[model samples]
Structure formats: structure tokens, C-alpha cells
Target: MTPAIYSPDEIARRIALFERIRHPHKLLSEIHRALNIVRAEVNQSRADMVEFAKQNPGMTIKPSPLPLICVIGPSGTAKSHVIKTYYEDVCRTENWQVGRRAVFDFELSVDANKRQFHVDALTALKDPDPEKGNESVLRRRFGKLTDKLGTELGLCDEVQHFIASDTGKRTKSVIDAMKKTLNTGICALGLFGTQKAADIFDASEEFGQRAHIRFDLKGGNPDVADDRALFVAFLKTFKTEIEKMGILISTKTLEDAETIGCLFLQASGRLGLCQRIMKAALRVALESGATTLLPVHFAVAIDRGKLLFGIKENHFASHAEAFAD
Candidate 1:
């Protein structure tokens, strides 16, 4: 028999059912709610930033809304995770509005020629001509589209791609166009990248001063104790939920899992990595027909992640050092 081809409505219903089942502890629910709050705040901030930029376009120096937050840190400091987490919290506070505005991640890339940078800004605002190729046409229509929809745009990822070349006229023009669009206040932009990327902006006095908030993750600051604690709590909660599903994870194994998790965080600072580790561990345990998660399961998960991330198992220290802090 052929498999059923589900309609969108059917697919949505199935998704809802799965969410309710898998997230009985409300972890996914909380994440959804948090995203909503972040969306609203991002919309408001975007509008405010656009207006401020337009009002003082010619001003060599001007203040921005709060500190334009620039998350700067090493490769594995979880800079992206921090931004995403904050965005989720903002969304949750707003109760996850059905039609509310939101901020989104942006990405930048360069072509093989490397002469120009690409800025892909994700927005809830409808694109009048989703197929429009002309930058001018998009800009002129973007304002009307955003005004009518009351939606906002968000930018993230490769923020450095938005910066135009200092000497090239075309590059400058492109950058100016982006700046003007941002000034319209339709959405707030959030940038997430490595320290080197942040340095690209810092090197330019014009862009450097525009950043309102700078979060440095490499200072060896002890203040992250709270964040670390929260992460540990999240892990414990996740482990409990898995156990309730009839998966028994031993205490020793859980400690080992946590140790591996901390190392992943230290290397990539990506929460996605942490989740992958957990999922892999659970899958391996299930495959073995074992009710409990064992050390081997964690070891397998860590090895899998390391391979995917192009890193080595030896790169991470043992749990002894992780627990010491």
C-alpha cells in the first residue's frame, strides 16, 4: 500500500498531537511562548531604530536604541544560543500571539568572486514582489508592505556581509540602501557571529559606534555561573522527561552525559549541539533495548557530534574538570 500524502491541515494536526505528547512537561510550549515575546520586542525595536536612523541620517554620530547588542565571543561560547534564548524569552512573555510581529535571523554570504556581500534578512513583512530582482523596487515596496501588515524584520548570522567595502561605490551604495531600509523601523536586527566577525564591525569606526550593546563571551568572566546553572537545570529536567518515557538513565551515566555536554558548549557554544548529543544518546539507548542510558550511549553521542562538528574526542577534557567548576 502506498503511504498517505498528508495535506497541510492534516500535517499541522499531526504536529500538534506530537507536540502535546512529546512536550507534556511543556518544554516546547515554553520555547514557543518565549519566541513570541522576542518577536514583539524585536518589532518595536526595529521601528524605533529605523525612525532614529532616518531622523539623524546625516549626523556623523548618534545614539541608538539601547545598546545595539553585539554578541562577540570565541567559536564555542554559545553566542548564537544566547541570542536565540533571549529571543525565546521575549516571545514567551508575549504569550505567543497568533498574528503578532516577530524578529528573525539573517545571514550573509559571499559569492565565489568575493566582490560583494549578500544580506538575507528574514521578515514577517510580505514581499510585494517576492520575485523582484531590482533592489530599488524591493525597497520602495517594503515600506508599504510592512506598514500594511504591521510586521517586523530581523537580521542575524553573517552580519559582516552587510558591511559595504570602504572604497567601492557599488558596495557603498548597497550598504546605504540597507541602512535606509533599517531606518524605516520595520524590524530590529540581531547579529550573531564569531569574534572575528564582530571585529570587522569594530574596525570600522562608523559601524563600531553604532553598536549599542556588546556581549563578550571570552573574558573568562565568572558571571556566567547563573547561565551555567540554568543549563544544568535544563539538562536535569530533560533527563527526567526522558525517564518518564520508560528510559532509565543511570546517575553515573547522566553525570558523564553532562560532562560531555559542557565540553560541547565550551567548544561551539551552540545549544543545538547539546540537543543533538541528548537525542543521539537516547536513540542509542533505545536501539540497544535497554531501559537505562549507559556510559557507552553518551560516549557514542559525543563521538557522533564530534565527527559532525569536525572535532576530535580528545579535544574535550574529562568530567573531572567539568565538575570542579
Candidate 2:
């Protein structure tokens, strides 16, 4: 029997998902949602594989490999924060007991060779002198450690290091090294990088095909209501977090649609930029001994930020309008 081809609607739906994973500027909540989805999927995959193994006794069961989740975004979008938070949380008992590892995290290097990559992984996995071994030995040791650790997930950060702008290029060797390090047929990989690292995956058909969970994250888009609402939620979270450090501000203002919209514009819809603005305002409040943050404080903070960040040309001239009089 011939295989059934997907209809146009199905194909379009698939393409939409593809594009969603490819586009950056995703909100933090969205990224968290994606990670949770990945966790559940890995769990189910583990369960199914165990069941299959029991039923088939002597047979080799090939569980579907988890997709490599490439968290890609611009520099200021809090991509590192997202990856770090998620990665650390995933490294605990549940993942490990399920024969899944929260792989040690390492930053990729531009000048790094394959041997060096292995050495880095081995070190992250707790091997003191991974540099002592050659590629073959390192690979064996690395694989052994992973098995011992019961790690199913591997994380590589700063993947943009593999993209060399000086030569205007990305090398296939680095890509292959990534595959070898994370996907050596034992571990599922999660990579974190900027657009350049994402390019590495898009250009390589083999990598792209396997990277089913590519998460392109960015700051919220100002024009999108859902985006703004999510950012406001993040602001509320920030308020709660900051209060733990003895500073409390009214995130209640963020609840106002007009106020939040203008703040979002000033931030250019980027959470990092929003944090910078708020943190600067917090500093001003700290110095003034003011516990309640007012619109005027944020306006001054925004101006100061323009000079400090060399973003004078993009000043928020009318941001004071967001102030609740």
C-alpha cells in the first residue's frame, strides 16, 4: 500500500509549527511551556520503551529519540536565563531515575576541535582530566559516564561560538562534533545560542531533521496583545522576586492596559530591556528611600538608560504618558 500524503491543511498546520519554532522573540512563559512539553514527551517515550522491552524480552527496542531543543534568540532576550533555569531544574532525580540525564552544561568555543569538545563534556560529567585521552578514548569514557549518570539530556550553550564571523562561516566539523557529543546514540541534546547557532541547524539537513523542538525565543512583540499580557505577567513575577531582596514596587501599575502598553513599547518588547529599565528605576528608588515606585521615577530611569546604553536615538520621549496621574 502506498503511504498517505498529508492534505494541504495538514501541511499548512505543520508549516505553522515549523515557523513558530523558527521565529525568535518568544515570551518566557512560552519557553517554559515548550520545555514542559519536552519533559512530558521524554517521560512517555521512556515509559513506552520500558513496556516494549518487557514484552519483547530479547529484542532491541529503539525508542524515538527526543528532539534537540535549540533555544535561539537575540543577545538581550534572556535566552541564557531561560536555558539555565530549565536545565538546572531538569537535572534532578526524576530525570536521572528515568534513565535520563540532565547533561552537564558547557559553552562551545570557536577554536575548539573535536577532541577539545569531548574533553569539555567529560569534564562536565565529572572527569578531571578529560584532556588526557584521544578522540576514541574520550568518546568511550564520555559514553560510559553518561550511562553511569543515567543522563538522557545533554546541554551545550554559547553555540554561536561555532559561527566564525571573521571567515564569514560555520564549519561542519563543529556541527558534527555537536551531534557526536550529545546525540552519540545515547543522549538527546539541547543547545542554546543566538541566530548564528540556529543557522548551523537550518543549513544542515541532517541536524534540522532531528531538531524537532527548536525553540526560537525573543522579547514580546508590542503589537501583539498576547505578547503584552505575558510580559505584564513577567513583570509581576519580577516584582515578587525583587521583594525577596527587600525592595518592593507596585506591579499593580502594570495591570493597567495603557500603562503596560507604553512600558512594553519603551522596552521594545524585550524582557531584558524591561528588566534593565525597572532595575534602574529600582536603584533610583533605593537611593531616594522611596518604597513606592512612581511613573516619574521610571521616566527618569528611562532617560538615564538611554545615555548609559548608548541608545539616545531611541529615547522614549512620550513614555511619561504611561504615568498614572
Candidate 3:
């Protein structure tokens, strides 16, 4: 039997449904606020760096000529969460009065292959002709955009394939052209990726040196006194917020969550994972037809560490058995 092909109308309807289902305005708003907070943090970080630079005038580091920052860490480390929160916060703070804020996220994962990168970036910039159907014309148009923005266009992602190790000469030329626009201070680039992404910057001495500041989320370990207190505080605060929303969590559930959080901290002590745990617990509660999450809810939420962290399912299963018992 032949597979059914979607007709044009069916395809359009599916697209509409997908957009409606996937695009949650409220969630997007929340995400926007989160990102703005991150941007503010980035700005503050930049300011602090500038002051530090002044104190050490001869320091090898220079001002981040481009607003590009590479957030690197293992999976479930909260790199994406941090970036999203920062982006939302930045947009909120900037758009408060004037309502003029421009923020966009370019997923390098989708365009990690050749041809797609150019298409994605150009389409994002709303280039008149993204096809590069006319190189000279496209360049002129891009130049105008840079001149107007007064800064280089920014790009964000885990690892940009455009700058991959095996990129060819032609690809390099395209990337170089993009870099030239940035060189004139018309754009600022931001990068988000896993620890392996460091190699991308390491590939080029210039890019490597550009990324000077680093933030790594160390999982808060309960065995460690400081981390224990932090974990408790995080859980307690989360509980309070959920309770305020008419959800009351049982002490047993809290204890279970604590155990889970500690296990996570022991394995991958990133705050990002902590947040996800809480998020998962809340989701489980909602799914169980209970306004408050109880121990069972947490149990339901704990599926190895897949829903916990990004740990392998089998590995997490062993750990989960130990924790569940």
C-alpha cells in the first residue's frame, strides 16, 4: 500500500493546527520576560567586566566587540533555561515604557547543515533576497541593515554548523562575509551550546579569546552543607509559589523531591536540572487530577533521570530503583 500524501489544503490545515497547538501566547510572554531578565544580567555582567577591564588596563581581554556569549555546559545543565530567562527579562525591561524591544532566537540545531544556515539567517533578517540569488544586491541590503541597527546582527544557538570544524572554503567565505558585517560594530552575536561547543571557539584563536566570561551551573549537592541549604531554599520557595496557586504539597512529597534533587545534584549538580525537577513535579501533579503534588506525584515524575536530567534512561532507571526503594 502507498503512503498517503497530504493534499495542499490538508498541509495548510496541519500547519495552522501545529502553530495553534505549539504557540502558547502566555508561555511565550513568560518566556519573553525570562529572556529579558537574562539580557539584563548579561548587560550587568558586561558592565562589571568593563569596570574590571579598567582596573586591569593591560588585561588581554577586550570589551565583547560583539554581544556574543557562548553558554556551554552538559545537557540539562540549564543553559537554554538561563538564555530564555535572560531573553525574556531583557525584552520586558526594554519594552516597559517605549514598547520597542527586538529579540529573536535562531536555533543552530535545525540549520546545522549547509545551505540551511544562510537561508535561516537571511530569512530572519528579512533580507529582500535570501536566495543570494544576487550576491552584490544581498550584500548591499545586509550592509544597510547593519548600518541602521548600529550593531552587528546577533546569532544564538548551541553550536552553529556554519562554523563547524569541517566547514569548506565556500562556507568559510560566507561566514567571513557575515563576520565583516559584525566587525563594523553593526551586530552583536550570542552563542549557546554544550561544553563540546568550546571546540568551535578553540578552532579560532580570535574567537576563543573573545569568549572570556563563563558561567557553569554546578549541581547543588546535599552532602555539601552550602549546596544542601541552597537546595532546600529552592524547594521551599517553589513550594510556596505553587501553594499560592491553590496547590498544597505534602511534606512527604517535599521530602521525595528533596531526595530526587539531591540525587540529581550528586549526578549533575546544575541549577537548571533543579528547576526542571520542580517543573516536572508540578506537571505530574496537574496530570494526576490533584491540585497539590504528593509523594506519588513525585514518584510519577521520576522516570530514571530522563525527566530529571538528560541522563541515560537505563542509568537513571538503576538510580531510580535505588531512590524509590
Say which candidate scores most in TM-score. 2
lDDT of 2 at 253: 55
Alpha-carbon RMSD, each predicted model = 9.3, 14.6, 11.0
TM per prediction: 0.59, 0.68, 0.62
Task: Please give the distance, in angstroms, between residue 32's alpha carbon in candidate 2 and its true position after superposition.
Answer: 4.6
lDDT of each: 0.48, 0.63, 0.50
lDDT of 1 at 20: 26
lDDT per residue, candidate 2, 137-241, as tens digits?
A: 988888788767766566777887767645533456666766665444456667888787777765578877877577776767767888867787776666555
Off by over 4 Å in 3: 1-67, 96-103, 110-118, 125-143, 149-155, 160-178, 221-224, 247-252, 255-267, 304-309, 313-325
Question: What local lDDT score does residue 251 receive in model 2, on the 0 to 100 scale?
Answer: 42
Cα error, residue 66 of model 3, in Å, equals: 3.6
- Candidate 2, residue 82: the lDDT equals 72
The Cα error of candidate 3 at residue 305, in Å, is 7.7
* Clashes per model (N, Cα, C within 3 A): 27, 6, 32
lDDT of 3: 0.50
Q: Ranking by TM-score, best first? A: 2, 3, 1
Residue-by-residue lDDT tens digits, candidate 1, 1-325: 3323445564444333322222122333443343445445655665665787789786544323322345555555455555555455554564645555445454555410112222143232434344354555555565555555454545456554434455544434544544555554544445566665564454446655655445555422224765455455555665665555433434245445556455344344344445555566655545544555555656655665666655565333353243223
The per-residue C-alpha lDDT of model 2 at residue 138 equals: 84
